[model samples]
Target chain A: MTKRAALTDLPLVLDRVSLSAGATTMLDRLNLAITPGAPTLVLGPNGAGKTSLLRVCMGLAAPSAGTVSWGGRTDRGLGRRAMLLQKPVMLRRSVAANVAYALAQAGCPRHRRAARTEELLDRVALLGLAARPARRLSSGEQQRVALARALAREPEILLLDEPTASLDPAATRHVEEIILMASQSGTKIVMASHDLGQVRRLAGDVVFLVRGRLCEHASVGDFFDRPSSAEAAAFIHGELVL
Target chain B: MSEGLDAWQLIASGDATLISIVRLSLTVTLGAVAVAAVVGLPLGALLALTRFPGRSALVVLVNGFMGLPPVVVGLTVYLLLSRSGPLGEFGLLFTPAAMVIAQALLVLPIIAALTRQTIEDLWREYRDELTAMGVGPTGRVATLLWDSRFSLITAMLAGFGRAAAEVGTVMIVGGNIDGFTRTMTTTIALETSKGDLPLAMGLGAILIGLILAINAAAWGLRLWSEQRVA
Candidate 1:
């Protein structure tokens, strides 16, 4: 069977997007564009709207105001993008089945599903535990399974929210490696993280946010070296941005 | 005393009449459950996943129907199938088919209401991930139903229990025709009315035992499957 057509040409643009829940704003007229390229890391303090931004970009949440478009089209580019929430909810099934579910959702042919599932499991080093229930796995292992599931979609754009937030150092390294491998394989990676070290190690560009508003968007090197905004500078220096 | 011993003896001997009644009971109730499940599960899943005008009212209506009186359902079906009634041409009244119809009507809301509750709870937990995966409406229903299978099995069992334990519906619709339409509950009611307490007690014991066994088997299956998949 042939692969689904890629959506790599579409650049995700958020034009003056604002999201509010009741009284509090989660995203404040945030204007940004995520073009096809290296991994872009979103850095922010607690409640900085990193998650909300990713949700809007993934088309999982509608912004209360303004518009989000992909390749100048306002449609959600379904099957072309996938997101791994901060805490992934595993299907009540085996590890292999979880990836297979994603594969099936991505419209993988019936005959190709098993092979594709196995390939995704192997990529995450979860082939040995293929028959194990996904929910019973360790948090780090579940995170990897979630990665494999996201990868199973062959998504052109993969969004992750703190994919390694609760993982140990070794597990974090493993996740980062898989992520970099996905990035190398032409998937545009947009990830949110709090770890500055991870940002330095994995990010090509940094989008910094403070209180639901964009503070800076620059190349990782420039953002880390020059530190444009006081909030970004203060954030990098390990000081409280608020 | 002697009566209790006779009831046990009747059960141990696998009395032909008793066995046939048990068989008919299983056939009608299981048939009713099958019919109800076919219609109710998808309807329940749809209610859980969709919203529209009067959806809440429909949900409330289905929930309220869960406690519908079996005698009332039996009377309604009787009227529907009685001679000179709209469906009289097919002649379903006072037959096992009539009993199945009445019991199905009695069980449908229980299964559907419980299934709606189960799928709704599961849907909440699965919403974001499924949406991100681009699963469509039908896919969402199928997923929620499959994942909530254990809970749904319990819902089905609840329906079965309701159908099996009630005598009024089957008694009215089946006419308690011995050697034909008689079921365990109907037979028990008939024997008791005729003062044949031993036979009634024996059938009562078997009915309770059968329900207990089914529930046990379902419980075990759910436990084993959950362990395998959890």
Candidate 2:
């Protein structure tokens, strides 16, 4: 299916956001705007706060100094959003039940839940294993189930943190395809990734972080070809950004 | 012992007094379990999910209560139910109702503490997913309790075992009135004291059987659920 226009809201805005613990800063005065379109990728080295950034946007963590507004809606009103964490947790049930639980929590009507669950599992290529226990699945399969769960929410903004970090190349390809499809269908995709090759394939725009600071935000082509910041340049060249 | 063999013969003969004792034992313990579950399940879920000042201290207190001496509980209940005590107006001392109350009090802490541990471990795994799904605090607790249903069943069984086996609480509160409030544990105590070794041994065997039956049932449920999940 082709990506549809966003149904909930447009342009998640973060203004002067900062998350700090004691003296350690995780996200420092970062500002950005995300509108529905192509996928946006967040890239940074370990401890650079890539995961923390996604968490803040998901409203799992409060920004110590700034505001994150989803079309003027606060976290309580952001119910139409769903996130897949770096280490996704599977509900202790059948694969289909995991997706269905998400659907139920999202307020999907009871009568329609089964069909929705089947469709989501099919989209993630997990239909055959619908009756299998979710936690008993392989790590790659579990990730797919987590993705299926996120899609079951019919979310406008889908946040993913290293969704394919544990997958093999074949599994990674399958996941990347579904992500691209979701982006094409107009579900705004915001993701954190360490694999540069993946960024090349999925990112429409790139947000680069260096030690809790927003070093650069650029379109994939511009960011790759022109390379505005030294960190982005070094990062693209496969050099670690401290 | 030859007395153990004779006790089996009494069980086989299905003596009326033995039947009444067994029935009473089941009633009192099951009643205690039901009452404890009503209060303990919510308390445990609350303790597992919420955080406030003194929570740690409260958790320690509940854990400590699990090891409460049955004789102390008996004396405390006895005093409260005596005509000179605060709750004397109820006139519940030396009755089955009093026995149920004492057993419920003893079982509550076991159910609550085990439930807290089980649900807390599950909450750790489920917190992010449930939160991202927009589930509220109540929803989180309900979901964790359901997902951890197998472990919670074991907790209930543990409460039942404690309730059924403890003699001090029921003996003091029920007064071990023959044919009126006599339970298997209390009957065993009376018969043993009267030197009727065979009957006491029979009641003891029946009590052990009931406990084993409960554990076996819980084990079966765990297996069935595990298979269904897999």
Task: Summarize candidate 1's per-residue lDDT along A98-133 as a digit string, tens digits.
Answer: 999999998889899999998999999999999998
Interface RMSD list for the candidates: 0.6, 1.3
Error of 2 at A151 (Å): 1.3
lDDT tens readout by residue for model 2, B115-223: 9999999888887878888787777878888888888899999999999999999999889898878888887787788788876776688789889988998899899
Each model's DockQ score: 0.85, 0.66
Lowest-scoring 10 consecutive residues by lDDT in candidate 1 chain B? B1-10
Q: Candidate 1: deviation at residue B181, Å?
A: 0.9
Q: What is the lDDT of residue A69 in candidate 2?
A: 84
Task: Give the alpha carbon lDDT tens digit for every residue of A67-186 in model 2.
Answer: 988877756444467899988988889999999998888778899999999999999999999999898999999999999988887888899999898889999999999998998887
Q: Tens digits of per-residue lDDT for model 1 on B1-230? A: 12444667777787777778889999999999999999999999989989999999999999999999999999889899998789999999889999999999999999999999999999999999999988999899989999889899999999999999999989988899888899989878877887888767877988999999999999999999999887
